[model samples]
Target: MTGWLDRAAENAHKFAQRNPRAVAAGVMFSLAGFAATAFGVASPSAPGTEIAQQIISEDVQPLPVHEQLEALAAHQLELNRSTAGRANDTADRLLSRLGVNDASAASFLRRERGVRDLLDGRVPRLFTARADESGRLKELVVRMPAERRDQITTHFTRVTLHPAGHGGWKVRREQAQLESQVRLGSGTVRNSLFTATDEAGLPDTIATQLSEMFSEEVDFHREIKKGDTFSVAYETLTADGEPITWNEGAGHLLAAEYINRGRVYQGMWVRDAMGRGAYVGMDGQPKQRSFLASPMEFSRVTSGFAMRMHPILQTMRAHQGVDYGAPVGTPVRTVGSGVVDFAGWRNGFGNVVEIQHDGDRSTLYAHLSRIDVRKGEHVEQGTRIGAVGATGWATGPHLHFEFRIRGVHQDPLQVAKATQTPMASVSRAELQQLATSARTQIAAARSMGAVRAE
Candidate 1:
């Protein structure tokens, strides 16, 4: 113990022996003061009046206020911007909108191999161009807003077009100088899919995309029940240079998920190790199936494949095809890539278009009023082969669709569901890596109302 503390303790011992209660109280108070001092607390040793009498006070004057001179800011120059019209699918129209009067430049842009997609109908855009007084475009900037997760441009990428030497034009790509924002949307399925998505303030296009994404796992047409919920995480585009962007609608839907009757399905756009993108599942499986959805865009199934009493024949027989009732001359589409096997008449089947697809599978479309494809000609999926009609086997106007595996008939509904192919291994792994972001997006989508990204 310190010498001062020891002396104090000795004095306290003496006080304790004389009056223990007074000593105990004084010890507690002393300990409290000691503790306060230890904690850097200012313990006043003298009374307020004594301290005030011994202290002096003084005040300093404030610094003099001064006016500072500053230079005026310059105004930003606005780019001359114009929109490509609906009929602007051609290079002439595109150059015209950009105020380019040069005919050779227009022809160059039209015939250039690399610029076809920029000039296509799918990505029609407004142009920000620098033109001369004579109406010759010195430079052109076209904004390509990201539309899909696997797309080339992530944010707002620009395609800058300019004149090259030798009276020719060249194109250069500009990185995304624009900002991208994330947003959320959520809703539970109630009466209909559109109603539920609309209630969540989601775009109809996004809802449709979500349905197509999850079609392999959930049947949106019949399996969707009440209380099933869906959520989406998407992006919006903006720019510092242009306050008003030509981009419309929500951009790429980065991630989406669904909880249908206690089962969960998620889809996230993931870029593989090779930098290729695909929508994948949590288990690293490629989930999207590219197939012709339905032969008839809109129709009612008047007759299905089953054994029934034939309308023309008296005896009950096996009905080998599904009949879709439509108008007299509705366009029928080929469901898959194949060669036309027989685009001619049969005994019971009228004008038929039989397609020989891979894996010994063939699709037959019968009762067509007219045929557009010739036998032995290759026809891609979604090709207009013929029009639906009642040409043979006495009946009303209906499309007789049949799916055959090695000549054995299979149900059309089952065929459609079995056609989905898993993506490659690289894409699957790439998609799995995006699980973390995808899950976070789903959470955001579930928690918030529709929020646009800035």
Candidate 2:
């Protein structure tokens, strides 16, 4: 029997040498068949039977680990692409539903072009897939980066009807709870606020809110200067303590704190003394100043307040007020609280609004595209009275703002000052304690690497 086995092995080697490729294939097939049989093919009665029969049996075909992982990644990428496109579409629909005009939506989407860069990698993106009981995709979230999450939340800014004490439902503004942040390093300008805030981990909407907060004083397109720094703190909405993302529900802005060029500015969402919803300073005052430091945020004063030849008129004029060479409809605001004594078209002044304030103070706004406040109506400091226009004796769209004391014209730039709100005696004492606690809390938060939502 030993001699016969040796002879069979020698014959097999000779056959393999004659047909090397065929032998190798046959051996591989036999090994595979043996494995299938060992793992329990459909029919244990046949060990090395037909490959098709073995496959049809209970033998499971196991994929390699690496191939399985590759397949999973591909599947996830496909899902991400599909979800992202759907999210974009959903955003457009939501914007339309919220009454955002097509032009505005286009502009907004244009500004959000950075989203493409953010979705570069096959990163796992989480989005709230809102659906009915049927499990359909009702909404898809274009997940915002951690830095911009606060500003990109899915919140609605709506005007609702409130029950008036006398009769009909009066239109009132209401919003969902939302949070935003803005961070501007030193030596930055106002125009770049959005970009800077985005880097510092704020959302675009929050940056817009920040700009609006200081619109009366800072012109994003003009007024910001190098060496100017800013930071913001604000609130965002959450569910069960988890901040909601854009794919979730909406939120409201609870409060905000801003600091610019060493000056601290703050705002709180509150019901005013008249029960109207508004944002006010820490002292319950509006977040505004009498006048902006410069009409142009970054432009040098080409001309000062003095007697000079008018550029277009080419005649020597007193130039009573400062000329802010801004675009048409640039808002012109009141420097202080007052009543509009005059809002009409005047010779050499075009559309004008003359305000008379307490202490014999008065102000005049001329060359306006339109007047907002009516005559005899009271207005607060920084209230928008008109929009800049090139009317009457002007060469371009610019605000011709003037300040007066007892009817005597004064330099608007030098005359306007910020009125400070004095703390009450009791409140002052409480403030000291509050400040102490605040300092401690701030330190703790900093140590823990946590940012505050002011």
Summarize candidate 2's per-residue lDDT along 330-421 as a digit string, tens digits: 77777677789999999999998998865446778778888899999999767888787888877777777777654656665544322222
Report the lDDT tens digits of candidate 1 across residue range 1-454.
Answer: 1332343345445435744443333321221101010000011122242222122110100011000001111121232546653544677877676666877667777778877677767654556777776767777777665443223233555788788888877788765644333445666777877677776556554565577567668877678889788877665444423322343443445578888898988886543223333456767566745356468888888777676789988789878878899997899999988789999898778989999875456899998999999999998888999999888884788899998865878667544643444244343333444566577657645543222110
Regions more than 4 Å wrong, model 2: 1-302, 417-454
lDDT of each: 0.60, 0.45
Report the error of model 2 at residue 60, Å.
Answer: 99
* Runs of candidate 1 exceeding 4 Å displacement: 1-77, 80-82, 86-123, 131-138, 142-185, 188-190, 195-206, 225-227, 234-254, 261-264, 269-280, 285-432, 450-454
Candidate 2: give its CA RMSD in angstroms: 29.1
Instruction: Please give the lDDT score at residue 396 for candidate 1.
Output: 86
**Pairs with backbone N, CA or C atoms under 3 Å apart (clashes), candidate 1:** none
Q: Against the correct fold, how does model 2 do in TM-score?
A: 0.29
